[model samples]
Target: MRGVVLHAPGDVRVEERDDPVIVAPTDAVIRLSATCVCGSDLWPYRGVEEVDGPSPMGHEYVGVVAEVGGEVRDVRPGQFVVGSFFASDNTCELCRAGYQSSCVHRVPIGGIGAQAEYLRVPLADGTLVATPGTPPDDLVPSLLAASDVLGTGWFAAVAAEVGPGKTVAVVGDGAVGLLGVLAARQLGAARIIAMSRHESRQALALEYGATDIVTERGDEGVARVKDLTDGLGAHSVIEAVGTQESMMQAIRSTRPGGHVGYVGVTHDVALPGMDLFFSHVHLHGGPAPVRRFLPELVDLICDRRIDPGKVFDLTLPLDRAPEGYEAMDERRAIKTLLTV
Candidate 1:
């Protein structure tokens, strides 16, 4: 088997590695049909996140089950499946409440890496969801999107309590943020505002159902969202970029009684208690319980109700993951899909 390894910042290499195998009764080994580089992958690659040593890369994946452990009964060999970045025991109390990302036995699959031909998925029965049947080739990329970006965006919308007739705003124009617009539309929001300075991302956001686009960011961005909402601010705002400015912009762009669903992986962020205490707004979000929405997302993709795969503007073979990373980091591609 071959997989990419990150020896240091800006350094990625694809080379032969030992094949992954089932090591737990609840584990499953799947031969990846497709995988991709995530926005989060750039953190370590850019040295924003510490790279202790050579690290395995990738987490989003869609594939066919090659093997399954004895305890994995929900999936079987030959079945095509999509899985979340974190493996969770769906039976846990947290999972039952639709927070599988924090399941009692949750495991981060990033440790094993999915940018390879094979991947060992823990908590297989809970983490992996099979499509209605083997998906057609065209639906593969959309299905892969459901495994992460789509699911995360959906979770953000839910957390923000978006509903028909409500005005919504998205703070970032990245893949997750663009999907947030799609999720808002699916949830019946009356108006969706996408904050993006990039014309390409702005176009995608519009196609995804955004009614307006705010080219400014930070304080200016918040004011723009408010201006469109008649100075009342949007009813719901999705914070997809985990940055201090983005977070504050999201909070400031929401109505007093509105909600802000933040799904960005936080990095050295702190909220001013005085401001939040008087904002009179609802706040919720973290690692999205993608597993919580996978089943429905998979169905939507298979039915062709959404085209999230368009996020993957750049596609390359798995071995060229380094180039894919560079493309995304350099803003040359919104997202990169790696073919196995």
Candidate 2:
């Protein structure tokens, strides 16, 4: 099989790799139908996240089950499924409490590398959710989105407490942020403010239900959000770009008692305790427990109630993953879909 490996910063290659085999009673091997480059992947590609050596890349995937261990019963060979970046035993206490990302035995799919012809997923029953049927060809991209970004965006909205009559602000306009706008709308946020200087992203934000667009960033962006909310700030803020500036913008855009849900992978961000304390804003963020929302999101996509797939502005053959990564890293594409 062929898979992606990052040799160093700016070096991503698809090369021959060993095939995956089930290694645990809860494992399942699936032939990837689709996978994509994630914003988080850029951290290492840009050297923000150190790479000790050649590292397997990519996490988001949607595929058809090829094999399942004896213990795996619900998911079977030939079923199309989607799984989150974090593989968890949904039966665990934390998972039962809707925090599958923190499950007792959580495994990161990124480390395993889904940008390949095949993948071995642990906690098969808990981590993989089967679609209603083999999804139509047109729905594949959307289903693939549900495997990660869509689910993460939904988690961001939920964590931000977006709800009826509330004003919501989203920082960042990446795939996750764009979907955050969609998620906020679905959760009934009365007004959504998407911050992005890119016209393409700003247009998509509006298409995804953003009522207002703020191109300003940092403190000025925060002020614009406040101005939209009549000087009270938004009731909920979703921070999808994990950066010091984006984080501070999110915190500052919310009202004193408001909630800020950050789903971006934090890199060099260090929050000032005193400033956050004085702000009186509720801050909550981490790896999105995407497993918890997979079922509902799958339903929404299958039913054509939402179109998160639109986030993927470019698609490439699995062998062309380098172009996909470059497109995203250069901000020439919103999201890149890799067809395996």
Model 1 spans > 4 angstroms off: none
Off by over 4 Å in 2: none
lDDT of 1: 0.94
**Residue lDDT tens for model 1, 1-340:** 9998898999999988889988999999999999999999999999999999888888999999999999888999999999999999999899999999999999998889999999999999989999888989999999999989999999999999999999999988889999999999999999999999999999999999999988998788888888899998999999999998888889999999999999998897899998888877999999999998998899889999999999999999998999999999999999999999
Enumerate clash totals for all models, in the order shown. Answer: 0, 0
Error of 1 at 213 (Å): 0.8
**Ten residues in sequence with the least summed lDDT for candidate 1:** 272-281
lDDT of 2 by residue, 1-340 (tens): 9999999999999999999998998999999999999999998998988988988888999999999999998999999999999999999899999999999999999999999999999999999999988999899999999988999999999999999999999999999999999999999999999999999999999999999999999889988998998898999999999989999999999999999999998888999999899889988879999999999999999999999999999999999999999999999999999999
Overall lDDT per candidate, in order of appearance: 0.94, 0.94
